[model samples]
Structure formats: C-alpha cells, structure tokens
Target: MSSASLKRLAVAVVAAAGAFALAMPTASATPARDNVKDKAEVIGKGKEKEKTVPVRLLSINDLHGNLEPPTGSSGRIADETGTVVDGVGGAAYLATYVKQYKNKDTVLVAAGDLIGASPLLSAAYHDEPTVEFLDMLGLSTSSAGNHEFDEGYTELKRIMKGGCHPVDGCSPAGKWKGSKFDFIAANVLDKKNKHALAPFYLEKINGEKVAFIGLVTATTPSIVTASGIAGLKFTEEVAAANRTSKFLAKRGVKAQVVLVHEGDQVTPNQSPDACPVVPGLGSRIANGLDAEVDLVISGHSHQAYICKVNDPKGNPRVFTQGSSFGRVLTQIDFQIDKNTGDIVRSSVVADNHVVRRTVTPDAQTVAFIDLWKSRTSAVANKPIGRITADMPNTASASGEVPLGNLIADAQLEGTKTGGNAQIALMNPGGIRAGLTYAGSSAGEGDGVVTYGEAFTVQPFNNLMQVVTLTGAQLKLLLEQQWVGGPNNQAFTKILQPSSNFTYTYSTSAAWGTKVSNIKIDGQPVTDAQTIRVAANNFLVGGGDAFAAFTSGTDLWSGPLDIDAFAAYLGAHSPVAPPVANHITVIP
Candidate 1:
C-alpha cells in the first residue's frame, strides 16, 4: 500500500489486529534508604491504644508512554556512585518491580506526564494504549503534566471521560473508555467556572484518608501552545498546593501528598538517592508547602533524586522525581496515627529503585504491549527515508545541535512554498530524539528511517506556523537565549537556525546586545527589515520564554510539524547530518 493509503487505513482501524471496545482507565525517600515496608504500628495506651495504619505509596513520573523498553540514554540511570545502569525500563519489567514492592496498603500513583510526547506505539492511537496500560497496571491517580495539555483541554477531558475521537471515531479496538484512575490539577482552572478541572483525589488506605493534590507547573502557560490551552488558567503551583492542603485539612484529611508536575534538575550523573541542595522549582515548592503536606512527588525536569527539603514549619519532607520513561520507581512509607488521622512525619522514609529488566517480565503486561504493537506496526514500520549516520542530539560548544539544525531546515523547506517562509528556528526542547542509521528490532533495514522512527524524533505534532517579524524583533528573539535578558530565561537555549541563517553571540556581551551580525541567506539584516520566520506554533506563540516571537505579524499556519518532517525526509532521502556551524560563539 502507498503511504497515503496506509495512513488512511491506520487512522481507520488504528492498528487492526483486535476487535474490542474502548475503555478509559487511569515518591521517594532515600538516595539509598533501606527497605522500609509498610506495617501497622501500635499507638496510645491500653483501652485508648489503636493500630496506626501504614501506607505504601509507589510512584513513577514522566512516563511519556514507553510501552517498550526505552533505548540509549533515555533507558539508563545513575547509581549511587554515578555509574550508569542500562536496560532499566520496560512496562513489563516495571510491573514486576511494582508487584514485588506493593503490599495490601500500597497505592500506585504518578506525578503526571503519563502521556504526551510518546513513541509511535502509543502516540499512533493518541496514547490510548498508554491510558490502557496505566489502567491495567492498577494506577490510582496522577497529576496533569504540561504535555497533557499538548492537544488542548478538550482532548484532555475526552481522555478523562471516555468517548470516541471527534475527528476519527473508534479505533479498531472499538470505543474508548476514559481512564479509570483520576487525574487532578489543582492549578489548572476553567476560566468560566473559576474552579480547577479536578482539584484533588482522595484515596483511602486502610481507613486512613490520604489526599493527593495534583498540580501542573505554573509555567505551563509559557511552555505549552497557548491555543490548545485556551480559556484555561494556570496558577502558581505552591500557592495552589497550599490552598488545597488547607482546604483538605479543614475537611479532616490530614495525610497529604503534593504530586506536582514540576521539578528541579540535579547534576548529571548524580546519584538517585543523594540529596544535594539544588535551587530548582521542585525545591522551592517543597520548601514552601504547608506542614500538613507530608510528601511531595514531582516530575517535569525528568531527573531522579531523593532530596530532603524542609516544609514551612521546618519539618523534614521528602521531595522526589523518578526518571522519565518508567525507568525508576519511588517507594514511600509513612504511618498515619489512628487517633489524630495525621501522618507521622518521623515515620516517612523514601527511596528510589531502578526498574531493572533483570527480573522476569510480567506475562500479562508483555501480552498487552504486544497487542498494541501489532496494531500500530502496519503504519509504524513503513520506511519514510534513509540516513547515512546517526543524527544525535548532542550539542556543540555553541549549543547548536545537528538534529535541531536538520529539523529547522525541514521546517524551512516545508513552509517555503505554502507560507513563503525565509527562515526557520526550531526550539531545542521540541526535538525529542535522534535518527539512527541502524535498524531497530522492528526489522526495518539499517540506514532505513521508518515513519515510527521519525515520529519518535518529533512527536508533539505542533503545527508549522510562519509569521513575519521585523529584524529588530528577530534580534530580540536571539537575545532571549541567556540570563539577564529581556526574556529572563533560566539558562541559555540557543535557537537552532536553518542552514541558511547565521548569527554571532558573545557570552561576555551585555544583555540585549549579545546577539550581533544577524544574517539571512548571507545578507546582513537591518533593524527595519521584515523577515518571514517558520517555527512550530508553540515557539511562535512565545513558548520557552521566547516572547519576542509573539510580536510577529502575518501568521500563516501549515501542516503539522511531524508531517513537515516526514515530508522532508521522503523528499531528501539518504539524508545526512547537518553541521552545527550556523552559530558563532564568543568568549
């Protein structure tokens, strides 16, 4: 079948192997804390004595729907000594770990990013397989990550409340049933209702009430495409969590866990169990949390660490993040006093464990993943292009990456005819993975790039947009790359320019004057010049703190970013890595 026909069929049947209906379904402590199992404890004296309920909380974050074992750097994690541990994650292996650690009082949960930016096996069906996988694994609740809003709030509601896709009806598997597990967002509120989509989810652990307050990062609005999240408001994470904690406390729910999809990045090669003090959003929120909030499980930064941060009342609290793609799981054990229904802060112990593939994989989970693979394989396996060598995401001294340059070039080519785009700038964050020349386990020949592989590299499906910006505004866009600038970026995020665009920047130059010698097609640009720029809608709308892009005029929307990339690959078969020489760095 031709590519177009295959695409139609894929959309029609979703992967076509099964005939079924759609159903929707669904922390840490030590850097190396010893095994602390959940056990009831005795408190009080004689007649007044009661058994304190012990609760075991198991968590994973930033899963990003890796039904199969992740490969490369995404699959490995650092040990206590900073040694890399490989072959760490797969859904089946993760399930085996969960089973071993779970007890009668165990509640499995996540800190958001359960879906979005997924592999082809999951993203093909709009991540329905991931939703089913979570439900099958017995997830109880989760927070909503910023990526959860990738397609917008309406689709998120559909994912939560079961329904057929408005555009593409039921998959070959039949009607979709929303998630059985709850997704709470304390900070994301509806503009009209002035209430959160779901403030919090309450779980009962052996008669003890545990409140899970889910919150997305407050900077969600600045990161996600503004259009998808139209009519929604993202408030401050710390304030929202505190407000929710106080409300739940008034209602007699004392044991609280804040699962916010925001976190800090630890040093590379940092041990997962080590608690090094880092100034991160996760640290700030954990420290600002009310004393009533006993634990904070976080995601978004995709770093794994078991850090101890003190709450507002100076009580030691555990703040953790399990590495992304199901590579790590955090086990938290705490006891609730039966008399006061409050958590014993001293009893809290948290540890991070690798989801090692050494264990026997869960039979049920293997079968489940295989089922989805069979369905998605038809479209996923089709070859789109070829590559001479791997185009990894490794950045140069100037912070430009070959993969990002290729993507920007693709975006530029994709928009030239339709939108008359003269230049394209791709955000580093938008490029998820690299293209490899070697064939994957799927049996596609080496040097062959399949549609699935391409999709994995650019999975967000952001629209390709062309907008006109004056040379001055364009200069401001480049100036926003570093700290102490108009945009106040946390770190330098040099935009990957197309092969035709070039510029120079000096780290020692004063803010706003760092960028110079801006050129498009070998011509120096003037302040009064107007240039057509091509980028994903997210960046064009000011994502990644590039607010200068919002000043562009004459907006022109084209195909989905993924489509543009795939088309570029097909047209430029036997593609090779682009040089990261477009940007010049100065001392």
Candidate 2:
C-alpha cells in the first residue's frame, strides 16, 4: 500500500479505538458535553503525536418534512444500473441508516430544504416534528433553503431560536425549543443590520478546527414568496463562500467546507457517483471556490451525484449531493493533517447510499411518527371522496398532469361563487404528490380519498383569488413559462389550465411568440378581450416568475386552496383522471 493509504488506515484505527473507549461505562459516568475536550483527551494518549486524523461527514438534503415513508414516486430509489427500487424513505428507516454509518468522527449535516412544502403530518404542527427528528439525529449544522423562508424571516428565526409560534402558539409537542443544530447562512443578509443571519459554524474534530460555511441560492428571492424575504438579501454564492473561507483562515482555521442549498441537474439513468459531463450552478460554484475551501455539499436540484471538480487553483475538490426526501444519504470520508489542520485533498472520497427499508427501523422514530399520526388522525382520516383510478402528478412534455388539471378546475369552481371566474391556472410546483387508488393507511378502502391525501396534494394553503386579465396579457403569461422571461425557469413550466382554457405553443418560435392560438371554451380569445381568471394568491402576486399575473384587475379573494380542493372532491364523487389534452405542444 501507498504511504498515504497506510497513514489513513492508522488514523481510522485510532479514531475507532477512541470511540470504543468513550462508549464504555466508567466510574464517574458523566456524559461528555464538551466535544473538543473529550476528543483531545481521547486522542492525546501515549505515542499519539500522529500527524493525521480521519473525519467522516454524513449528509442528507431536501427532506421536506417527510417524517413518514414517502408515497408514490417520491419513495423510490434509483441504482447505478438504471433500475428503480421501491419502498424506501421513512424517518425511522433514515435514522437506522444514520446510526449504522455513524462513528466517533462522524459529523452529520444537511445542505437545505429540511422542511417546508411538507406533508400534512408535519405541516399540521408547523414542522416542529421534523426539527425534533433532526435534533435526535444529532445534526451538527445545515444551510438554509428557499422554503425555510416560507412563513417569513420571523418564523424562520422562531424555528432556529426555539419558542411558541407567535401565531399558532404551542403544538402538541409543547413549547418549541427550536433546533439543536446551527443553521449557518453566509449569503443571506439582514437588510437592516447588513450582516449575515448566521455566517459560519466552527467544529473541532480530534484537536483540529474545521469551518463550515452555508449559503442559499442567489435566486432565493425570485422563487420564494415576496413577503417572506422582504428584509433579506441573498448574495452571490461563490463570492460569499470565498469571503467566508478568507475570514476563517484569519482565525487559524484551514479545513473548510461549504454547505450550499443550490445544486446542478445530472443526466437521467446515470450513477449517483458519476461526475457531471456538463456542470451546473453547483459545479460552477465548486470550481470557482478558493483553494482554501476543500469541499462542497449541495441540494435544491435534488439530483444525487459525487464529483471531483477543480478549484480556481486547479486542485480537485469533492462535490456531492443526495437525492431529496430521505431516500439517500451521502457519506464523505477524508483525512486531515493534525499538525497543519488542513484537509488532505487527495484522501477525500464520497459515495451515495440508498436508505433501504430492509433493516430494522429506529423504534424511537417509529413511535414519534406514530404519535403525530394519531394526533392528526381525526382530521387526516376524514373521507373527502373517491377516485376511479390513481391521479398521478407526473407531467408530460406539455407539462400537464391529471392532478394539476383537477386542482385548477377546483379553484375555478370554488371562486365562481363570488367572482365571475372563467378559468384557473395552477403552478406545477404547487402540486406536491399524487392521489393513489390504494389509500395510505388502514381503515380506508381502495380508491378512497382522505383529507390528508388532498392536503398532501395542495399543502401550501394559498388563498384563492379571481382577477381580470386582457387576452394580450394572458399570451405574455404563457410565454413566461419558458426561458428568457422574468422567472427564467430551467424548463418550460406549462401552467395547468382549467377545462375551459386551451392553448398551443410552438417550440420553434421566438420567446414572446412561442404561445399562440389561445382560446377559452373553443372560442378564439381576442387581444382586447378581458377574462376573469381564478388562481392562488401566489400566482396573483407573480410568484414563480409569472409577472403578467400581477397586471390583472378586479381582484377578489376566495377560500384556501386545500379547502377548495377538498370541497371539490366531496362535490364530485368517483372522480376519474382528467383527459391530458388541455395544452398542446408544437414541435
């Protein structure tokens, strides 16, 4: 074996010995709360002037409040052979996997999206359960995702600082004690103080200090609700990481890692351990980082991969991401030079592991999930309606889906009670999951739809609104679905239109002219014609870059989106999948 390999093995042995010694019962038997002091004493024993230390980093991202096993496509895992494996992802299973891989040197962290857009189980209690779960898993630190600001900065602070919610008061979990982990945001700045929310977190591992810098995507403001980020500024990611690394260096900390909430898309069917052929934002950030920054962990795009991209100084550094919803966990191992407190760049290695359910689940997590499930059972189990078949949220080339169409139709019908709504448009991102024919739990029969299922489909609870828009403005809204628009979506986000609306768009046409042949009820919509449209307040406020919606007039507020959807389900029993022919795509 090479000298470097031998050195790494020795370091691992020492770390394992230290961990075993710490686990054994002693006379004093007092739990060690000071990590640095404990590590120093454990590694300081005879002939232990070793110049290297082994460190393990275990990470997960985009959990999105899935305390229970995710249903439908969200629960599946993809292997290197392009085969899909089912029945994965539950907090209990995740906890089991985390414990299996954890060692004394392990430092657990997450890139972002730990909560927000959560399922009804977690969302019912404002995601306090997820926070508790992370604390139990011993998360050391994490970055903030755009969804972290879903309820605004004050609520985010409440999540981090621990307290009863200002509005919802205390949950069944009682007064919230916030998260035990540090949430560091190097790029997110307080507009009033001109300082970062939580700039950097420092960890001392085996007598060496390591710095973790966290950052959200620079495009946070464009995607998140406007009011949620009114007083915060998200700066460029690379610059923020570079500046943070410089600051850490001045403090005599050289081992640096960046936990960013932005990531790149990988080719379909590729192995999670494969490097990208064409790098995206995550790769760009990793490649542009200063030499002092040794590693990057990313999330948001939800793609799983392990890559080695070159830094600005042409030295290769590790970059990795795990898929969303607790289905995968990334394990990164590296060696640090104890003398210099610098990471051995050549010793870094990373791999993605599937959270397979075959193993024994953590009993505590299972009971915790059951506690929340029973608490929410009364409302969650109430029958909303029935379906003839599954209404999958999967979209086609034109971006239309059975569930999206149903949601838009429901919004239009619900809003028509007070406003003359002709059509409704639903953003694709708003649809979280699909309606399965086989119900989630016991007591519910096949094809039966419950309030929990409906809530899962539309969890945002955005208020419905009706507004008047000219036919000209409607065309602009359709054009905004593609690139070169204010939102700059990576792909075309075809708005899910109600049954009355039909439109065709040409892929070959120019940006503004891509959308053509717009109509309502098979009648051509004239440029000067004004139509009343039904949509969620998010769309009306120009969320997701559909700025044309902001120009609408004669606005009228309606019911919460989930309530409207539930009422629609109850009103129309035995609902069948809507024909996916609303939007036409021209080659």
Candidate 3:
C-alpha cells in the first residue's frame, strides 16, 4: 500500500477508534473493583473490630501483553544478581496464579504499560485483546505509563471502553459485561480545564477504605509526543499523589497505596536469594516518600526486586515492581482496619514466579482467557512469519549490538520512499525482546530474523515516518539524548540511536552539550545539506522533547514502524546481518 494510503488508514482508524475505543467512564457507571460487594457501595460511618481484615494486594507491571512466556535478562543488576535470567514470563501462567488465588478480599492491580508498546499478538488488535484478558484477570485499577501515551489518551480510553468497534478497531465496552476498574490518571490533568482526567480512586476492600493513586513519571513530556498529550498536563508524580491523598482523606478514606509506572536503584546485597534492595528507575520512587501512604507498586523499566521501602518521606512504605512480561507477581498482602478506614499496620512478601506456559493454564482463568483468546485467535496465534535462526536482544556488556543495528536498518529501509539514504536511527528502548538463534554458537549468516523478531524491536505500532532536516537539526536530534541537566542527579538511560551514525563525545561533557562529531556513512556529519531521517511519529512530533526533529519536514507519510519492519523482513525474511553490529557508543 502507498504511504499516503497507510497514513490515511492510520488517521481514520485513530478517529474512528476514538469514538468507540476512547470512550471514558462516567463517574457513577464505572465498574467497582472486582469482588467488592455491589450493593455495599458506601460504607457506614463507623465499623470496628477490623482485626485481620486481610486485603490480598496483587500487583503487576510491564505486562507488555506477552500472553506467552518471555525470555528474561541475564547480567549483574541493582543489588540483584545480573545473569541470564530464565525466559519465564507469560500472561497465561500469570492467569493461573491470579485465578488460583482469587477470593472475596483480593484486589488485583497493574501499575502500567498494561497496554501500548506491546507484542504483535496484542498490539495487532490495537490492544483490546489484552484489555479483554486483563478484565478476565481482574484488574481493579491501572496507572498510566509513558507508553500509554504512545497511542495517545484517546486510544487508551478506547481500550478501557472495551474496544473501538463497529469495525475492526475497538470492541464494545459492554463486551466487558460490567467491569468497574477505573483507568486512573491522578497526575494527568486537563490542560484546558485545569482539572484531572481521572483523579484518585477509592476501592472498598473488606469494608475497609483503600485508595489507589496512579501516576506516570514526571518525565513523560520529554519521552512521549507532546501532541498526543497536548491538552493534558502531567504534573509531578509526588505532588499529584499528595493532592489525591488529600482528596481521598476528604472522602473519608485513609488506607492508601501508590501504583507507579517508575522504578528505583538498589544494591545487590539487599537479599541473598533475591535482590534485597531492587535498583533503577521505577523502584527508586519509594526511597523518598511522604504522606500516609502504605504501599507502592512500581514498574516501567522492566526489572524485578522487593524491599521494605520508605516513601519520599521517611515513613515506612513497602514497594514492589514485579519484572515485566509476566515474569513475577509482586505480592503484598495487607491487614486492614475498617474502624480506622486505613491499614493499621502492614507486612510485605514478594516473589518473581516464572510464568511457564508449559504449566497447565488455570482452569477458570484459562477458560476466561480461552473464550477471549478464541475470539482474538485469528491474529493472536497467526504466525506473522518465522525465523530460521535466533535473534538476541543483546548489546554486549560493552553496549555495542547487532540486534540494534538490524532494527535500525529495518526502520531506515522500511520508512524510505525507496531511496539509499544509508542511515536509520532507532532508540534502544524500542527493542522489546531477543530472538533465540537456532544453533548454540554464532557464525556466517547462520541466524535469521522472524516476524516475531521484528515485532519485538518495534512493538509500539509506531509507524516509521521519514523527515528532512538540516545539519543543525540533525545535530539537535543527537544532542537531545542525555535528558535533565548535566549535573542533574536524576538517573536516565540515554537515548540510543538506531543507525550506524556515530558521534564522539566526552561523557564528562555537561548535559545538553554532550554530543559532537556527527558522522554519516563514516564521514564528519554536516549541517549544510538536508538529510532524510526516520523515526516513529511520536518522536517526529517531538516526543521525548526532541522539538528540533519535529521542526523538520515530514518527507513522506509513514507506516507503523513494526508493520514496516514486518514487511521488510517478510520480503527478505531471514535477515541475519553480520554479527559485528553497527551501534558504537563512545565516551
């Protein structure tokens, strides 16, 4: 299909999807947390003897819609053993545990990325199938993630509404048969109205008042397209949570927990069997917390660990982020008190269970998943194509990687109006999974790329859009990689470009001034000529605050990066590039 036609298809689907898929729940009609009593809507002013009022708090993050098991990372990680972790993640297996443990007092929660930036199995149907599956899994509430903005607030609203249908877009909200989980976005305020899209939510568990405050990281604007979130204001996560806590307090609720799409850094010595102090982005939020919050469930950067964390304030706060891809279930069982309308006290327990698909899919949950999986089976199980070899998402410990190169090439080639530009830039974060090579060792053109492999790298369904930029604009694009200020203490994974283009820079250079030596096809990168560039529409629109790139000319209408790569791989299926990958990050 022509790029223009694909662009039209993308636009029409978005708008049409908006109408049905993006529909939001009116306050009163939104489904209550699953298993909470239907008629016991409002609790009485006072109820005592709330001893042992156990509320099974179940949390999952970065599910990324891997309905099947996922291959995990191997290496040294924050306070955690970094090694080749086993490939043990699958929603089917996750379903088994969740369903097996279902009871009257359980509350299942997801921090975010429950949708968006997902495998073709789920993203293919615009993530509705995943939503359907989540509904079956009993998702009581979910926070927003940066990837949620990948498709914009509109489509997210659709996934929540059950689908964007009448066409193949979204399924009807009614198809959910009345699920009360609210897609909460406490920090996401309306730019026009200066109000929130959806604020703090209260879930009455065991007749005890519990509130969930959902917020993505404050850095959302710098990572997602401003246009998609144009009318919304993403305030600071801490401030937003604080604001919501006050509101919940006013509503006569006390026990509260934060469901964040961020993680933190921890030491390898935190635990012997497990990383006691989990490390990195999302998990770190609990390091400094304040307020009467009891627990926090964090995610977004896909890693796993547990700790008796303290919130922004010095009070005790137990936070956990189960690794993404159904690798583990972070469990924090709580003891509630109805009289106090809060958690009088709490204890924590966490384990990263391997979601082995080989295990018998739980009977009831599998039945639920089976029904929907069957409905979505047409695409869910359909092979996009196959690989003759293994593809690993490995960037050697030194950070250079062939997988990154292959994807960059795919995007560069896929987006072109059919020219030989010899340049493709890919953000490392987009590469989702590693494809397993068929043979044990690597040699020759022994491995191949599959449709699944392509999907893993460019899973967001972000279309590959080509643009034109001057040397200055290209330089600006390269410079936006570091984030925050040079001296800023905030931790971040610098943006990795998808192409072979390399830049020499001083890691010691001040932030915002770090990139230099722009090169193309192995020569000094220049500013005098116009260079054709490729990126997901999000990045093209200044997503990640790369306003300079968005300033360039849109050379041609784009196709979802994954689809483009899929077509590219399909036309030339077994794409096993030379093992000596192109990415070279020099300090």
Candidate 4:
C-alpha cells in the first residue's frame, strides 16, 4: 500500500477502535505463563546436542529525539584512536548503521530517554515521529529512563499504546500506533494497579528463550517532576533485578539480560570502546545483581563504557552503556548453551561502535525526517531574537552557566506580573543545549535565534511558577545542593540564581553552612523575611531532588518556559552572555 493509503487505514482503524485501540494487546503481549512455554523452544534433545546458538544484541540509549542529525558537540564522537568525528547522528544515518549490523538473529533494544528533551523536529509533534522511527528500525524492547516520566505515566501509556493524545489529539500523520517495542520497567510499580507497567519481555532467538528485564534508577522520583510520578513507586534497582531474575528462572528461562536506565561515567580521556574498571552506580548494580543475568545494558549518564564486573556469585558479567544522542551503538555477540538455556559467558564479546556519517543514508528514514522537517520549518525557522555572541551551556567553577542565568532571569521577568516574583532559580539539568550566535540545523543567519533553537535549550516547556518562601527556607534550599542532601546528586547542583540574587559558597564548609552572604536587590536576606521566588513547575514540585521547593507557598503559574525565554530574547535583542559572577565559590 502507498504511504498515504496506509496512514488512512491506520486512522480509520483508530477511529473505529476508539481512542483506546492501541491499549489493546497485540500478539507480542501474550500472557506471561503462555509466553514462557511458547517461547522456550528446546533444541537438540539428544546427548550430542547442538553446541550453541549465536545471538546478537544491538542497543542504543538516551536518544533524546534527535530525529535529524545533531550538530556541534552533541553530534561529535571519538574513535578508538581518540580522534573526534562530527556530524554523525541522525535517524537516517543511524538506520543505515542498524541495517548494516542487523541480521535475522539480532535483537534490537534501547536503554530509554528515547523521546524526552527532544529537538523541535520531534518535540513539536509530541515525539510521535520518534516512536514511528523506532518502530521502523525494529526496536524489540527498552527500559524506562527518568526522562520517560517527564510527561507523567498516563502520557507514557499513550506513547506505548496506539491512540490520539488525550490533550493534543492525533498527529498530522494520523492516529498514533504507539511503539512496536515493549517498554519494560520492572522497578516502577503502578500504585493503583500494584504491578509493573510491563515487567519483562521474553524473546526467542534460534529456539533459545532470553528474558529482558528493564529497570530505571531508584532515584527517578527525585530527578523527574514529582507530579509526573505521583502515582508510581520506584524500587531499589538491585533488589528489583534480583526479583525479576529469580522469577524468570522459575519459569524455566535461565538466559536473562538487564536493560537498565542507569550508568557510570568513565575516566575523561577513556575511549568509547574501553572497558574501564571504575565503580559507579552502573557497576554497583552489576555487582549486586543475581548471577543468572548475563549482560546489562545501561544509560542516563550519557557516557560510553563496557566493563566486566563480577556478579554476587563471583561470575564476570558484561555491563555496557552507549553514549547519548545516537552517537554510539553497543553490540554484544554471545552464544546460548542449548543444553542449559543459559548464556555461554566465555562467548560474550561486546563493543561500542560509532555511528559514522560515511555510510549511505537510509532512503526511508530520510524521507520520513524530511517530511517532518518541512512540516515544522515554518515555526522552527522563524527568528525569535538575536544574540550578540554564543551563550554556551558551559558551567563556571561555581556551577553557574550563562544560559542558566538567562533562563532564570526570564522566569523572574515572566512571572512578575502574576506573581510579584523576586528571584528566579534555574536547574542546570533543565538546560538541554546552548544557543550559538550562528544558526543551527534549523537554518537561520548569524546571531539569529529561532524558535526551534530556543525550544532545544528549554525543551521541557515547564510552566513558570512563583512561590512564597521564607528566607530561612531559601537558605535550606541552597544548602540542599551538597552531596548528602535529599537530591543525592553525586556533584553539587548549584542552582543558577537570577542576576538580582547573589550568594557565596565555600567548598570546605559543612553541608548546612556552605552558603553565606546571601542578598537580593542589594539588601541582606533575613531568615524571617518572606520572599517570592520564581522557578519552573518542576522545581516548585521538588524535581531534581530539590525537596526544599516543596515548602514554598502561594504558588502562581505563568507561561511556558520556552515562551518566557523567547520573549526575553525578543525584548532584549542583541543579547550577550551574562557574567558568571552571580555565584561565588571559595576553597
């Protein structure tokens, strides 16, 4: 059938099936008991059984909706020789690489963050294009990353099951068919249902059953917006994996792999293919998992590494992460013993391959991408404002960056009318990209900032909120940036304060005493004084583990963050990077 006709048929089916048609099960969603028996096809019953069956696992993580090729630092990758290569990632090129490496025995998977924090080409349409692209590429399964909860669990369900968005309705391409791949999150329990969203997916390759168990980080609640995960519970990763592994074993399936959305950062100069011996969250989880799990695929730190960590049983297991934004693909080749239904640990060979731009682009992906680009070009290309110079997202010694300052100032300005806002705080994690003085892939002149460019920087579109907080509470909030705080962030998350708010911190000071010399509008802040502060909805709801924001009162919501940022740039044309002196750090 022609593409248009196929779309029409899909729309018709959706219309006839109603809004929840996608929620219905497909052949892939067979019941667990039946799935095990049906998929566990025992091969070679004789004593001289077949030696082994080769299986290839291809995986990617943290895609973040770069349907088109990313540019600048986001698109660059380093080869084994430590030389950097650029202009590498785009759906077209990535599809080409997947096709080159894929075979009938290959199973494709992802470690999540596939759609959130996306660029305009995908985000403008609510990431439907990305889901479609993944379907076309034949993704079998994936773990739920923290960003997957950005839009809340209900929206995530819509993304998985075919249906028009409850709020945004159907896309221009017609009804959504959800994703062909199953999104398994064994650790994320639905409070209402008391079960996992989709716990584990069992796939049979070469007559051998392999179970893929998925889990997001236990800290998911702290990183994602509180409201998005209000009805869910994130359990400890190691415990969750162990439980799932044991459950699979009971069902006569011994070959198990974990697709988790947590990872560690290797040494700065480490090559993408290097298997570092470093210890971090990923390594710790790997070391703690049940011995039945043979391989672990991870992401969320956006770093690349392939480490062989010993499990609790003192067996060496593979733990790997592919860098974010389609820059790398992790390939694992192993053999499953026909006699035992377990992986041959010695046969496991894993490597991270760069998705190079040298290959011929896939024609289908190019056409799909071009169609969306043209549809979004009008709003994406329209100039929002001009910048005098590049305002990169690079943080200063104090963890304050120019773009963060600009966003905080914008929030303060945007909320002033409705909120009597005094100071605005921007989370460093919310800033996705930098605004270059020259145009980006959206194609505009030098210094021109397009709507698409601004969208890329603040992709969350969180509502701007102004809340009332006492000076004492504000101080506690600042102190929460340390390591032992509620956030549990490994590094200090120095909040980017508006220009009017200034403070000094000492690295050597005790946790609660690190921040001092606080002032707003040139006046010393007194503990008893009440202040109206502006922040995104995520912040006010205690996202990124800033639980202190939850104590604020008299909340006032304003425009979307991206709109506020665009308006700020327009009002202040020829905008230059702000000075990095707002935050002071001392040894």
User: What lDDT would each prediction earn against the true structure?
Assistant: 0.82, 0.82, 0.61, 0.83
**Candidate 1 runs further than 4 Å off:** 1-51
What lDDT tens digits, residue by residue, belong to model 1 across residues 1-587? 23333233223322221321221011011001111112232243562455577889999999998989987667789976789988998899999999899987898989998999998899888888999989888888899999888878888878877798898788778899887876777777665434345556666666667778888998888889897789988878887777767766765778889999999888888888877746778888889988999899999988999888888878898889898999998999999898888889889898889888989999999998999889989999999888899888778899999989989999999999979999999999887777878899899989999998888888998999999999999999999888787665867788999999999999889988999999999999999999999999999999999999999999999998989888998999889999889999887
Task: Provide TM-scores for the models.
Answer: 0.91, 0.92, 0.79, 0.91
lDDT of 4 by residue, 1-587 (tens): 23333233223321231222122123333222222212233355662466788889999999999988776678887777767777777789899989989986789999989989999999888888998999999888889898888888878877887799888788889998777776777777664333345566777777777888888988888888777887888888887778767766865778999999989877764678887746778888888989999999999888888888888888898999999999898899999998898999999999888888888999999999999989899988999899999888888888999989998998889999989999999999899888888766556889999998899899997999989999999999999888876567666687899999999899998888999999998899999999999999888998777888899999888899999999999999988889989888888
Worst 10 residues of 4 by lDDT: 13-22
Tens-place lDDT digits, model 2, residues 302-336: 88899888888888899999989998989999999
lDDT of 3 by residue, 1-587 (tens): 23333233223322231332122223322322321222132234553432546677777888776765555352112223444334455677788777766677778888887877777656666666677688778787788787777767665665555434445643522343323465676667664433334554556565566777788887787677665576777776776677556555654557888888887654432321254553555544565444577887788766666666655555666767776777666666767664566775544445554444556766765565456545645543334444565556666543545666666666777765653344666666667766665521212223444454456566766666777888887876666665553323244333444556666555667766666777777777677878888777666766655667667774565667777666766676656643543433455
**Candidate order (TM-score):** 2, 4, 1, 3
Error at 297, model 4, angstroms: 0.5
Instruction: Locate the minimum summed-lDDT window of 10 residues in model 2.
Output: 27-36
Q: What is model 4's C-alpha RMSD?
A: 6.7
- The TM-score of predicted model 3 comes to 0.79
**Residue 456 accuracy (lDDT) in model 4:** 89
